[model samples]
Target: MNIEIIEIPKIEDYRGNIAVIENDVVPFEIKRVYYLFDVPSNAKRGGHAHKELFQLLLPLSGSFDVVLHDGENQQKITLNKPDKGLLIKPKTWRELDNFSSGAVCLVISSDVFKEEDYIRDFNEFLEYIR
Candidate 1:
């Protein structure tokens, strides 16, 4: 399992800062864009992994913890800044947790929603990725 944090270059102006995502800036061809926000406490999300789609996740508002496991290997990453995002490659099981109050997560996907492209089970994901 490999995880990488991508730093988005921020440009500061008189009003605020801006970060842009041009095509092919990262890996894979982006086909879908979505965001997760207004997450309530005492709750967890993203207990699945895509079989083919890759994702670049950014914490636009606050912070959160992303726990990843590939059966034998496990790791956790904390995302807290808008200028930085995590690149979740395909075939890696993931779970998002420890969301700070009012944390917002944005995701850029390599493909559209396809049930066959998702590996919803951790054990299954581990086997498939191998």
Candidate 2:
């Protein structure tokens, strides 16, 4: 349950606002950046946990829900702000769903893609955390 909600710095102007994410804003050194977009209303994403990866999920557009578990406790959160992000530490389970239309989720990770680092099974994730 070490999950954190990060507030990205926003620069405001008469025309528009800009949200900035610098290296100092995040706890880890980001090595990858990805996003999920155009997901169907009923479609779901992310039902796994990483062994060592740290991720920050930001709602760039629309809204979505994220469920996080630490093998003993669970929490659910709604992401609807472009200037806020959810930080997920390693060895924690995550599931995402309830996506609104045109929802865009931005993900910043601590490492590149590696299949062996994912724990796709809930039971396995719980066992590994123990």
Candidate 3:
């Protein structure tokens, strides 16, 4: 499992900063965009793996932690800055947790939502990877 944290191009001025993300920023082309917000501190999301879907996660507001597993190896990464994006590859099991108050999670996906592409069970994900 190779995860990359990319720094998005940011333009700063007296007012605020703007981050720009184009099609070429990630290895996979973006086909879907979604965001998670207004989550409670004890709430968690994303406990699954995709067969062919790739995702890029950005912390637009506060912060959160993502745990990635590839059946043999695992890693935990924290996203706390708006200027960075976490690239999650296919076949990697992921779990989102430890969300702070008012945290907003922005996601860019390589494909649209497909129920058949998702492996929701941890045991199933492990077997599929093997």
Which wins on TM-score, candidate 1 or candidate 3?
3
lDDT per residue as tens, model 1, 6-65 = 888789899999988777466888889999987875578899987777899999999989
Question: Residue pairs in steric clash, candidate 1?
Answer: none
lDDT of each: 0.86, 0.95, 0.92
**Poorest 10 consecutive residues by lDDT, candidate 2:** 121-130
Question: Tens digits of per-residue lDDT for model 2 on 1-130?
Answer: 9699999999999999999999989999989999999999898899999999999999999999999999999999999999999999999899999999999999999999999999999999988988
lDDT of 2 at 39: 94
Error (Å) of candidate 3 at residue 94 is: 0.6
Q: Rank the candidates by lDDT, best first.
A: 2, 3, 1
Please provide TM-scores, in order, for all candidate models, with all chains considered together: 0.91, 0.98, 0.96
Which residue pairs clash within candidate 2? none
lDDT of 3: 0.92
State the displacement of the C-alpha of residue 59, model 1, in Å, after optimal TM-score superposition: 0.5
Candidate 3 C-alpha error for residue 65, in Å: 0.5
In the range 30-66, model 3's lDDT, one tens digit per residue, is: 8999999998888879999999998999999999999
